[model samples]
Target: MLPIALVVAMCLGAQASLFLALTSSQDRMALAGEHELASTALREEQDSLLRLLKDYAFWDSAYQRLSLRLDTAFADENLGLYLAPAHGLDYSFVLDGQDRTIYATRGTAKTTQTALTALGAPVVRAVSAVRRIGPGGDPRVVGFTLVEGHLALFGVSAILPSPDSKMRERPGPRALMILVDYVDAGMMHELANRYRLADLRLTGARPGSSANLPVTLYGGEVAGHLTWSPYQPGTNARHQLLPWMLAVGLVVIFLAIVAVRMGRASARELIASEAKARHLAHHDTLTLLPNRRAFMERLKLREESEQAGILYLDLDGFKEVNDVFGHGAGDALLKAATERLQSIVSWRGILARIGGDEFAVLITGPLAREGAECLAQAVVQAFDEPFETAGHNLSVGTSIGVVFDNGDLSGEEMVRRADIAMYVAKSEGKHRYRAYDPSMERGRELTKQLESDLHRAIGTDQIYVLFQPVVNAGDGRTIGVEALARWRHPDRGEISPDIFIPIAEKSGLIVALGRQILREACQHTRSTGLDLAVNLSPAQFWNDNLFEDITSILEETEFPTHRLELEITENYLLRRPEAAAQVLNRLRRIGIRVALDDFGTGYASVAYLKRFKMDKLKLDRSFVERIANDSEAASVASAMIALGQALNLNIAAEGVETEDQARALRIAGCTHLQGWLFGRPQASSTLMAEIPLSRRA
Candidate 1:
């Protein structure tokens, strides 16, 4: 009995020590993870604030209103009321080139202070730092500072023109925009909720007994400390096991063997849980694929001297599918896509779902480039077949961008270049792959410039309407005019519609630009008494306010609805046939005639022609251009014109550059001819003057 008692005592002590050690180790890991999470959350908040500030500071409209024009109304509308509660911003200020405060807002109210006197030297210091960077440099400063004895996050940026603005060349001291948000109780509460911490708060001084993280400025000055109740996983576990432990101690000899087995089982479960947690951290839950962090880490592991190939893929039309169907269907589609990609990339590369509808492939070692290209092609072809999900056959494609490491690029840069190439592929057309080239970077910069400039062009004189006469076939008399949008870029001269139109569409500027063009066209031709035809972009047509905006524009310009015609392409109609039918019916109800522009370019069947109730069909330029040169083209064009006539739709042949083409189309039952043959697209004033001449000719 003495020997058993001694053995039991030793065993119990050893087990207690082992269990305490395990729990302590787990607690330490949990604490370390919590600390990292807290730090990351703070950094992310700063980044978000900086991004928000840059968004307003580097805007053309903000520059124009605050720096160039000094429009206070604009300041009050945007920098004042808009930035307050919506963004959790506590203070907003705009300073001129001379360091004079031109605008100031405290919360949602405009302040009379012409200077940031309340903010003291911190504002001046931040502004000076930003100015030191200058317009050519980073031109932004963001940090934490104490404002009126309270901790706050602040961002200061030089109010410079957008990347595409011509004003970038203007010589002067640039203005500055300042935004501030306080680190108040609400923010602390939010952090607590996010990180699952307790009693999170900011303290001017370090607390004697609490888990605290120091908030440091850019200059390494400790402004304050964030205090939180640290999670004590070990203590909690010890408490939970204490009752059972006491019971085991009471029957030590009897339950010794049972307790050992249970201890082993518990240890296994804890290890398994830890393994699962690690996997969850690095993988996407939906597809069980490696996530963005895992992908980046793996890419970073490649040697700088090693050659590698990276492929960035973005799923096309996934958002539309997700919207029209449901997330369940989208998830199923993604899973199926993952399987297909896995098959193509089997044993060749690492595949990861970086984000929503975006995936990345990394290939290294010999023949990496060749393998990547083949994999990309296979991936593109794999998506050609419709995916079966949620009782629906969903058709979607992928645009892949492939880049090979030149032994000089970093992993992040390789990924960036691959992403850019993918965007280029999607822009040119989806369902294709593009190899990265040096020129693509330049093209991307130019595209960014264009997107920025295009925003300023709308509602300004830079964007205007050009009228191209639609002449009656056989007689050469101008019966109607089509309004085309033209952009006269300040520096680049005449920017083609083909270039900027797609940019506008891609950037979601199409709806506004389309409305502007429509209003301008109606206003320009309100006195011409000729039929006015305007084109509608897919974005404009799908806009919820399309009918309202169009009718409002017509009413504002006093343009007759019966004489106004809106042209839509067949591709858009084909995508959403039911929705298109409904929108078309709405447009026709308002007595607006809708024409099918660029007809015969796509697979528009007779059923679509009758179903869509189009008033006119504009024969595609490709068909019209080839009609006079090719026999088959002529037969096809003639058949299209006859089909239009049979459907009681006016047939307009576009791109009629030669008399032969015009005569061919006229003989083939074309009612209207529009192209360089009759009249090139001209300014509204110039076209109005030539209207009588066109009638007489």
Candidate 2:
């Protein structure tokens, strides 16, 4: 018994010693990681400055202006007060061919204009080093510098003379230099916050401190040091160490008890975390409903259950909500919709937000089919009341498809069939419900095939453009042509734009389609001198670089922008009015004519007419068709024409299929006309020869 007691005592001492050693090693490793992280952050900042310098130095404009040595105005406009503050740069310098500073500005505000004579010795050294490397060689020179009592990271690069020999008529050597922000107390604190280090500061070297990283400048000179120390407890060292000593003593007294409790607690925590993860994986976060995975699981579990029905529901016009009111509003609308749906489903039905605006429900009971249909009707009725989301009173409709279990169908099969029915309900008319029918499968197959073929068509040379002539109402002479994109599926023949345009929009292919159409139109009409009008989709506006796209097309085709007219619908403006207005303003400034197409078909507020600069308004065919008989339609057409005249805007009557309709439109004071009467949409080659080139107002 005495020998056993002595061995146990020796084991406890050895274990305590091992714990202390491990704790010290962990502390050292943690400190090393913090120091390494700080150094990386500093190096990343240096890299960022080098990238900015390269972007400015390698540019064609910089090359031309710097080589000439006569463009101080270039520096004044770009490197003055705005550039430094906007880009978080400290100093901007444009050096001439002979490594002479042509323009230099320092500080965040450019208030301190830096001259070559006043340049700091450290900065001059960096510039001289980059010059020695020569322009058209290395792109960047990075180093630290001690300037104005602060250590700053400096980057310098030689500006390559333009590859266009025309710009280098007179030049020697050219380069650009920039001084990044200096590392001060505020910058050090910022770095500490980013790296989560404590009490980071610049300090003299500590011989054995692993937390010290050396800062080197040009010519391998030591600029300064970046150093940090470990975080300390708020209390005295004695108080901080007291708890640890007590813990060690307790560990020695109840070693087995402490180990058992810790192991159990860790096991319990791990079990709880894994359970939460599994629940989250199967549940929708937004609606707290079963997700697709969970829904499928439930369906599989209840496959043999009697009288089960699966109802698949999709919200119609949901995309419009996202496009018009934004994704936040869409989310809010979905949440509100789920609550309404929940009330109808109650506790008996399993409701899930499958994805997006789609929802699925699994119902079981003797009257499951009837209950499902009733619930679907209730959902349809619920949407009749407008949804108030973020001050936008939006309206949406639900199309539901219900499929009752036939005792043989799997859950996935039932859901797929129900989805097919839902699409059919949507196609027939939204805000309705339909029970799954086998006949619907054929149409679904066709849709899938069409989508697949469309993908193939887009990848190949199957899509083409045609032009439709817009003629004067009185003389029946073509004045302008509207370009129309057409798709000729190799096996299916000519596909209507109406049928494929929506597909393109849904598939996110509209932007590429619009770009191709624009390019084709510009190329076709470049020399024809006929005013060219191209319809622009609302989706096209989402491309923030659309202005650059138009500019590039014009430059490439050399098409006269003044003769190119872009027609957009009022819905496009309503979706994103400010963005549309900005785009229109840019287009108008560049000599492009903007026109409102399908004018009466959308939200026609005269306020939009006043806000947007439009060259013309094309009267929709609905009003034109009604003008032949409906007095109200005739009055609206006359009113629209008068409004256009009052605004000094051109009004064009479209879809004029009959002589009577054309006559009525002409009598109503519409200045221009387009449709079947004018000419069907045809190849540009055919229409170009028909319209004479010589015409003026």
Candidate 3:
């Protein structure tokens, strides 16, 4: 009987020990889950705040009124009043390019105090960090800060123009918009309830008895601690099991069995959670499509099959949809686009969203190239119908680049080639697909080299401005000279403007190049008494500092603004009619002349011509070349000139090579004629030398 009792006691003790160990393990797992949940909740809150700030900051109206114009009324009406009670924001501030507060709001009321004054050095640090990152950075920041000794969450974002804005690519200083939310009783209670955290509160120091999360500031300084009562399942379970253990030894055996089942259930839950995390990591959150990582992984694992193909696609005019509508609409459009792509791709390919408005497809098996082309064509056709999203019918197109594996290339190389082709397709014109070619790669390399060279050539003698004489239509005498940029490559000889000019524009080097050309032309013609015409790229024209840059150049060269004629294309005018009108009016106010160049090539209508109020209309060369042979072309050219004449605008015919074309233009009421016939684009020195002789003629 004694031996049996001792054995029974040993069994009971072992059961109790096993029970305690299992409960303790479960408790640790529970605590880990709670910590992760709390961390994720904090991160989610930060992301939500950032999204709100982005919605406001990346807007045309916000950029224009707050950053560009600093309209206080607009800020109060649109931004300030919407904060506080509506959005639960404590304060909102708009800082100018110089980090000075241009607008501020406390709750729903406008405040005189700046972000720096209200929030202290933290605001300055955040702004400085964002500026340091510049255009390449995330452009938005969210972090914690101690405002008035209270823990607060803040988000700072650069005031950037919407994707559809004409000033999207125009480089300049950016204003910052800041939104602050304080951690008060109500916010703590909401967080506690949302995260299932008990007694969650912000404290100045870490609590010994509670689970604490450090509230880090923008610069990584620990501002405060968020403490919460930890739920200990192990301790609770042990207390409940202790009474059973003391009452009956058999209860320990039953509790141990229960604990074993609970442990197995917890293990299964953990495995499922891990699987969910993996799925999320591999898939896009919006479309649930395999993301870039998954696509690349599959690509790398692809067999060396001759029939494999890749297609890279980019959405054309999607930015306009985002800018005009909103991000919500943009997201809906993306999902719609994904659905359309999936319908086309079906089971033939693996589709993934690689970047913003960019997608990739991988296909294998027989006739992969043909299949890719078919898929590409279908994808392009799918977007032909406008997508109805957010109660708005938005039209967007896609450019696709297709590549077939040669069995020698890696997956990354194939994707890269496809990307290059896609860009080429976009450059040629959107809503089309281009197959990857060996020559295209060579051309891409050459373009990169040229872009690098062009950067170094600006403001140097390697890049010089040449002048093409604009002659009187009847007498053929030089009246004004239009400045044309020319580049003399050191090794490759003279690089055509047709090649380098586009490169400069694409690289944002056109701003500096345009300025240099303007200065040189003004300096050369300051004493020549010749009206100076200089073409402004869409980039240079839309530059925020355009007026100031032009004024400074004119002043530095002592060139009269009245004698300056800036030529803009029809394309630029169609981009933002209202904004272009304002810019044109401002130029006219300062005694500068604006001309509509390459007329009749774009979507400029009669109303646009009248509304823009330009000084001249330059007929595109297509009309001139066709006018000599095609009577229909001559009539159109004549009518265009007649319209310009009725508007009291000068009509300049460009690319006049023959006397017949010249006579046709002259009879059609063209005031100015420019072509090789008048003398091809020459150096400023050549024009200067001919000035006296031209005057003699």
* Reference-based lDDT, residue 384, model 2: 87
List TM-scores for all candidates, in order. Answer: 0.61, 0.49, 0.56
Q: What is the lDDT of candidate 1?
A: 0.82
- RMSD to true structure for each model, in Å: 8.9, 15.6, 11.1
Question: Model 1, residue 498: displacement in angstroms?
Answer: 1.5
- Count of backbone clashes for each model? 0, 1, 0
Query: Candidate 2 lDDT, tens digit per residue, 1-697?
Result: 6677677667666655544444454455455555556666676567667666655665555665554454665565556654566565666766665656667777534434453444467667777776677434675777777666677767777775333211232344555656566677877897777565677888645436666777877667776778777532212222334355446754554654443344344445444544544555566667778888789988888746577888899988887777666778889989888888888888759999887789998988888888888887887888788777677777788999999974678887898889878878886767899998888877656655766677667745688888888877777767788899899988889888877786666554677788888988899878776788998886686566688888898899999889999888877787768867888998899899988988875555788899996899999888988898899999999998999999999999888888988899889899898888778999988887766655312
Candidate 1: C-alpha RMSD after superposition: 8.9
Tell me the whole-model lDDT of each prediction, alpha carbons only.
Answer: 0.82, 0.73, 0.82
> Which of the two, 1 or 2, has more lDDT?
1
Q: What ordering of candidates by lDDT runs from best to worst?
A: 3, 1, 2
In the predicted model 3, the residue pairs found to clash are: none
Error of 3 at 585 (Å): 3.5
Better candidate by TM-score, 1 or 2: 1
Off by over 4 Å in 2: 1-305, 322-356, 359-395, 409-413, 416-461, 506-509, 526-529, 555-558, 570-578, 600-608, 631-646, 667-669, 688-697
